[model samples]
Target: MKLVTYLLLGVKKIGVIHNSGNVIDITDIVNTDDMNVLIEQYAAVEHLLKKICVDSDARGLPLADVHLMAPIPAIRRNIFCVGKNYYAHAQEFGNSGFDSSAAAGNVPAYPIIFSKPSTSVCGPGATVDSTLDPCNTIDYEAELAVVLGKKGRVSDSDDPMTYVFGYTLVNDLTSRQLQKRHSQWLLGKGIDGFCPMGPVLVTADEFGVPANQKIRCTVNGEPRQEAAISDLIFDIPTLIKTIGQNITLLPGDIIATGTPAGVGLGFTPPRYLAIGDKVTVSMAEIGELTNTII
Candidate 1:
């Protein structure tokens, strides 16, 4: 089932997307506030969702009637991001000769990971502020994001395939200059309104073959990045397993798997984003996520 967190008439509620292309209110069946207590609640929440199918047929709400919020608008923790996981992205960054030593032939054997401060998170249709400092050179990266359903300690032996909740699109906005100046990725990636996520979240079952899913991004109407999730140098399981090797994984935690080749910074002349540029990040099976630079 396609679950959704949405706002209807100014009130936020949880619901299930129906077959007839409608949204059925299931908020009354499951307590939204209780979701934060544990990951297992997702199973219970799903159980109650079964009843909505009946009620929806009789009194279901149409998709056109409500405003959609991020499947989880206000997740309690920072969003984890993986970098240089796609070989193409690594190749481009390396070939650009911006990092000459890196360009020649240096690639990390492990996943480069970081966190986006929770404050940077924003919902669908939200406007992102472009803090266009004179020294700032901002860029965009489109990536497939995984949402965790089960919390596990880094030492846990279970695989990540069992811990996933769903999938969503992520735009990892960057300030290239800040990144280079600080030698830390957070300075470039964690800007407010930099991470635009979700039209909605698709349950894990709905996104079969998570690793092989196709992903792409376009500026305005021109395609920039295009590749498959399978292109990831560090696949989801390895990423989760590796991160879990030290850091704890929590439910509602979001992990951005990294982008493909063709980012603005990878260009010969460097095509940074300007004010009023519209970007659309899309994946097959999953829907398109669009946002504009301000």
Candidate 2:
């Protein structure tokens, strides 16, 4: 089932997505605070969903009735992101004549992990301030985001799937100018409203086949990037397994799988985002995630 974090009547609440485009409030069913506690202990979010499913109130509103927030709104900790996990994206940034000075290199044998400030996460329809900082090069990356259900340390024997809650779409907004200047990603990617996610977070069981999902990204109604999740070099399992071996993966923790090629920077003149540009990232089982650049 799909889960959503929403604000209705000025109160934030949680709910399960209904087939009729409505949202069933599972807030009363699951112990949300307890779920947060479990998350702190690196426990799964699915357990909470299961509880909600078993004991839900009849009170539900149409998805159109509430204001949606990030599926895991107000996560106790920051979200994690994987960078250049796609060979094509790594090649585009390192070899695509956009940054002619850099040399194309071999894909890193290990996952390149990073962090996007939790504050940057916004929900669908949220306005992303492309010009928020003084950076001139605003870029967009479409990635499949994985939400962790529990925490685990990085180790060889770790099973990343056991910690997974579900998946969602993420727009890895970037300030290319800043990125090049510092050679670090934090400032370039951690700006408020940079990581726009969710209309809702679909549970893993509801996500259909993990390897066959279709992922595509479009800007202003035109397709820019398209590929299957199958193309990922550091697939979800590897990512979780690798990352978990080193750090504790907690519930509500997000991991944005790297994007495919065809980003604005990969264009002839290096097309950067402008005021009012719209970016839409979609997947087959997961819902669409759209945001406007301001």
Candidate 3:
């Protein structure tokens, strides 16, 4: 079932988005409004959630009346992000001349990983404060973010897929100049409000095997990026293995799979984000996550 974290009547609540486009308030029922706790205990609660979804007498709050938050609004730690996971985006970055992490070529031999501070996360439709970028070279990268449910260090005997909770979208905003100057990612990509994530988190069972899902991003309604999940140079399982080898993956951890090509910097003359630009990242199975620069 599709799940969400939202605000209704000035209270943060956990909800299930019913097929009718209304929200089934599960906040009180879940015993904890923290999405991390809910996910960590999902296996124990799945049956109840399913029963609620089909209950004819259950009341659903109108979707239009509530404010949507990122499916997991308060991520427990810095988000694990993949860089240049898509072949086309890899080549574009290598050619853009803003890349500093390339060893020999555009493509990575393994996943290029980085992290965005949890403070960087904002919900859908929230305004992205672009002033944080002194460089004024703000750019947008649309990516599919993986949300982990289980806690463990993935090893040869563990199946990484079992650790997945669900999926969401993240627009990995960047400061081109800072990235080029630092020659590393954190300073450039970890700006406050840089990560705008989620319209909702579609559970793994409901989202199904996502290898073929399409991800598209538009800037002020104009198409900029589009690619299938299959286009990634490094797939999800490989990413989980790479990161979970020693570090214990925990509930509420987000791994933003790298974006596909067609970012603003991909152009001969870059079309960086400007004030009032509306950037939208979408996956058909999930929903659109649109945010405007302030």
Identify the leading candidate in terms of lDDT.
3
Native-to-model Cα distance after best TM-score fit, residue 268 in candidate 2, in Å: 1.1
- Which segments of candidate 3 are over 4 A away from where they belong? none
Candidate 1 TM-score versus the reference? 0.91
Q: Which candidate leads the pack in TM-score?
A: 3
Q: RMSD of candidate 3 to the true fold?
A: 1.0
Tens-digit per-residue lDDT, 1-294, candidate 3? 889999987899999987677899998888988999999889899999988877878779887789999888888999999998888888888888888996525599888999999889999999988889998999999999999999999999989999899999999999989989999899999999899999999999899888979999999999999999998888999999999998999988899999999999999899999999999999999989999999
Model 1 segments more than 4 A misplaced: 33-40, 50-59, 97-105, 132-136, 154-157
Query: Looking at model 2, which ten-residue stretch has the lowest summed lDDT?
Result: 96-105
Local error of candidate 3 at residue 193 (angstroms): 0.7
Candidate 2 clashes between residue pairs 3 or more apart in a chain or in different chains: 42-151, 151-249, 152-249, 153-244, 153-245, 154-244, 154-245, 154-246, 155-245
Q: Candidate 2 at 117: error in angstroms?
A: 0.8
Order the candidates by TM-score, highest first: 3, 1, 2
For candidate 2, the lDDT comes to 0.77
What lDDT does model 1 reach? 0.77
Model 2, runs deviating above 4 Å: 33-59, 96-104
Q: How many clashes show up per model?
A: 2, 9, 0
lDDT of 1 by residue, 1-294 (tens): 677777888988877777666887766666652233324586766655655654544566786688776666677888889877788788777666444322234455877878898777776777778864345577889989988888776556676688788888889988877776666778678887788887667888878888678998999999999997877898998887887777778888889998999999898789999889998899876677888878
